[model samples]
Target: MPKPAPGLPTREQILDFIATSSTPAGKREIAKAFGLTAQQKIILKAMLKDMADEGLIDSAPGRAFHKMGGVPKVTVLRIVDADDGGNVWAVPENWHAETPAPRLRVRERKRGALGVGDRILARTEEAGNGWIAHPMKALARGEELILGVLRQEGSKLWLQGVEKKERREFQVSDAGEGKPGDLVLAEKAGRPPRITARVTEVLGDPFAPRSFSLIAIHKLGIPTVFSPETIEGAEKIAKTPLGEGFGENGREDLRHVPIVAIDPADARDHDDAVWATSDDDPKNDGGWKAIVAIADVSFYVRPGSDLDREARRRGNSVYFPDRVVPMLPEILSADVCSLKQGADRAALVCHMQIGKSGELKSWRFTRAVVRIAANIAYEDAQAAIDGQIDHPLTDTALKPLWACWRALYKAREKRSPLDLDLPERRVVLDEKGRIMSVAPRERLDAHKLIEDYMIAANVAAAKALEAKKAPVMYRVHEEPSREKLVALKDYLKTFGVEFALGQVVRPATFNHILDKVGEVDFRQQVMEQVLRTQTQAYYAPANHGHFGLALGSYAHFTSPIRRYADLIVHRALVSAYKLGPGGLTEGEAAGMERIGEGISALERRAMEAERDTIDRYVAAFLAERVGQVVETRITGVTNFGFFATVEGIGGDGLMPVRDIGGEYFRFDEAARKLVGEHSGTEYASGQRLPLRLAEANPVSGALRFEMVDGKGAAPERDVKPARVIKRRGRPANIRHQGRKR
Candidate 1:
């Protein structure tokens, strides 16, 4: 290399110097070695800063300028794509700021060795002006626990993986005395077609009732049992009653307020309560002041303690249909911290004043001590409000809550949020845990009232923390992607409903499309498709403005006993406003970004686990009803198969392509339809048909259905979308809507 003895070195010269240097280079040393003047040093400084900003060099370690990461000679990568011609491409696992990270082609021998979503550590070299990689080792899948079924094939044992995306089977030498059809846990060794495993445990037989949830719980690695240390810590705290930590220093006595908690009929742990009264001051005539009090979990679960550590690890509580894996021990979530009637409990309170026009005028937060006046279920409260039942407490206690709900409802109407009405199913169980029946849950005004109250409180908490300029984890939802809109528009075109594409659209645009759904017969199908096009909401440190609720800022602030995110928000408010003990610490503030990401990941994991558990339960319920005719709707279609969701039961099943008919099907990806080649028969979404339950496998949570009366193959025809007939009155068949508490 040419010796750097110039006034100002070029970019190429700088790169070459650093590449050849054995020692780390600093600006002062670089300037001295290059013989640069004072003005030239400034130019070099600017160039280095620009380079560092572009990720060409590291600037974190003060003046020691080091080359940033690039494609390493030996690095780990994930196989992202494989072509029909047997060419496999991968990108670096730990790459820097490069968008669409540089791809490397694998050697021909290793091209088809790994499947999609597999990771590999490889040795790479620059070749043919591109890059070539040779796999040195295959990285193991991240999941520590392997869930599968023990299969006996002619006296040889194998473990069939449970995951839908994974296909490889493991050979088991030691079966742990597990029989065929039993769910098993195996320790996998080696890779690909030659992988081996040893059965460590034999879960129950898959066909047994209620065994589905147990299998899913272990398969997903959800922690169900608490450790002895954690239990001891909980018991020690539980020994103290609710009033042991309360004092007048920073706590407000709200015992005089007649607050009541509204929850589900079978709810065991109540974490929130509401009380509202007419604003007495003339400045707020015809208005109301609503107070929402949440259980003060932080007061007992302090930072760096055993309880706090375990709660943080679990992130939040997970509830299956049959049981719950609580974030805190039952002693806290169900007893001390639960907002039970007539019980004095610690609370974090949000007080909001609304105007006659239903707009919020002001709001504040406080640490409080409260006594709940009564406990009411949603159904009973609605009945009381409607005057259908002559309840003694209706005029005395429930009237004020209904009044406040009226004003809040007005404000919600003015807000015009994205409202997609999709009723959920609740499965009832008998004493022995067998599914008795499944029905759609009723959406009562009382439920909406409590939801409005919680939403207002959550928003106020976010606003209060933001006004104080404190670090906060916001509940955010972004606008849907353009690609999703394009596909949604195509689907909408099938119904002769036009979607204004390639423009800046608002939530109201979706509301408009949904409004037109009543003009068609497939209301449920259209709503499901519309919901799939929207973005999922999540937690983050930066504010992204929730699209679904149409709120500029929002956060989870209720139910601290169940959700850790709410607890974190409470701590941030306490620290920001100088509330006593259990405030957010400096260490937590500095790591809030990482904390948000960790808790968001935990939230997704909990959602997936719950969904899987429910799927298993539904499949087990349907296993007994095989060969019975059921109403089904086509939810998705592809060349390989079509997925249908059963009516009333809400269980989804697959009807394979061969079973649809003995004909080749052409898949139209954009239109999301499958067309038969021989008969020109079409299978599309939003189509309702009758089917018989062919099989229900609880082990894999798989439900299979076969079309009845040869109705699987239907000829395509141009038919007008029919308008739905509006119902006259509320039907007597009211179902209890199972909600995620």
Candidate 2:
């Protein structure tokens, strides 16, 4: 038996060692520092375990120890929030404690200013008042945190991902006091097969309706709660009244114009309104004069203000089935800035002269105070124009808008934009938060009328900025790359369609291709490929023409209440037209490139979160119909499996390759198809097949399908089996074999 050391450290001494250790202090390190014998080391291990049970010290990976409710001495920190005084605060990038993470005031060093969404390696210290962090060095932004549900299998705990595309489960290293079946926010710590994570937060039941969006909000790090300072600023701005005066204080009164706001019935905020009339001038006969009044958000949320900072961070409002996370506070987004009917509101108006051919002849911008004549829903406006409903505002508003749209449609047809029939699915929910129905929203002429007018206004804004030689944040969608177009051409050739690579591509080129394949079985498949071949749109200071709209100049000038990019354009117009206060500052113009990039990234973040929430809602709606057969169409094909979505109820499900039949299938990369080795059975994308709803996991939003006709097997052949091809460092099933022509 080994003898105990002469002196053993007290519990307080051990706690101090852990709290102040520069590196992860494990049991061996502690033993060496104390010069303890073998028996004394055993005693020290017992003490550490007792401390963990008592909730005094946390046992981290590699047997490291730290105080409960405390971060490591040197660890990664993410900037989360900032004060009105420019003091930034951060939290541990991978916090795993029961209590809320303690905010650390970052001490600005020579390293430079740290803004929100920045990551840094900092040395943390527990000060007398609170925690403080000093920058050691800056670090690149880390991977996004994972949101999942904790599940226990025997002695092991696992985190099941909530995203539809996440198929593998993560092994949990620390549960952070979370239990099985609890929704959690975790961070990845290790790689696959033995993938590990540490739980950072314990959210409630995953099956709840509100939890679906909440999961997405947290997963994407979306800012849901507004700062008190920002909210107060919005309220203060909302209280300022618009004085009654025409052409005074740089504001024009256009209250006499019968302007109308048309939007969705469920829309909470109305930001734009339109009015138009026939031109009486003989020289401009058959022309129309129009006004587009958008909410002047820049007037309220000015540069360098708390409200402006918050709006810029949010970029745009995120709309979900249950709620909307607005860019501005509700006091401004839904009440003050919103163009409510019979209410006087501040607006930035665009005046345009359109000729008979719908060509914009001239345009100007001005600040104005206008009263919205009426706020009509799209369905009601369409019904009124169809003579199905006798409405008072139909002749005053609906008919004139439709007449203007008729002329605009002529120009739109001449432009020939890349038109794709992509139907959007809408989820309807009851007051109790239960889903009522999920269906495709019907397209209407009323929607198109508003869209065309908005497009004209946006073009005018961009062109006006260019005339002033001012910086413009152009909405850019460049043409597809040669690689994608080549792949697309190969895919089309399978159907015997011709595509010339040497020709200069235009939106009309894609339109012609679709027209050639009109209403065929593979038209939807071809459309999907065309969409995949298009480039993603983004905002940039340098102008790159919008390929999708076929517009040489385009900027977002509508819906300033929801979009920050529109707000920036409004400020630019105010600056260029000398429309008085809230004009773009010199500093803002200088930083336009950086601002554009940041807002573009934020926009993508909002889109991803919104799409993910919708997927979760769809999965929840279909959870009750498991085991029933559903009509599905193959949306994509891969080496491992094929993905299909329900005909109407939209949620993609995977049909594994192994479950299809008892035969080896070879994947054709160029053709996007899979063929059985012996039976020669072929399955390709865009094909319709009946599949059974095998599995639907609402928590993960994952679905699995099976063939309704039962597993297919190849007939026995009295011949030698096909030669198996083996490749080093490749899976046996995924190895490609030469095919006989």
Highest lDDT among the candidates is held by which one?
A: 2
lDDT tens digits, residue span 1-741, model 2: 122336777788788778767777888878877778888988998788667656688755345777877777777899866666667789987654557988999998842377665799998888886899999999986655788999899999999888766767888999988899999988765322334789988998899877888988898888989999998989998887654232356578899999999999999999999999887889877688899999988888899999999999999999989999999999999999999999889999999988888988899998889999999999999999999998888887778878888888888989988999888889999999899998888889999899999999999999999999988888989887666788889989987889998899999999999998889878988998999989778887878789999999999999899988899999999888878778898998998877887788788888988888888888888888888889999988887768989888888888877667777887666567778878988778888888888888777677788878767222233323234344555323343334334
Best by TM-score: 1
Error of 2 at 738 (Å): 21
Which residue pairs show backbone clashes in model 1?
Answer: none
lDDT of 1 by residue, 401-515 (tens): 8888888889888878888888776767787877787678889998998999999998999999999999887988877766578778988887777898766767778888888
- How high is the CA lDDT of each candidate model? 0.77, 0.83
In model 2, which regions exceed 4 Å deviation?
1-144, 165-177, 187-198, 243-250, 712-741
Candidate 2: global Cα-lDDT? Answer: 0.83
TM-scores, in order shown?
0.79, 0.78
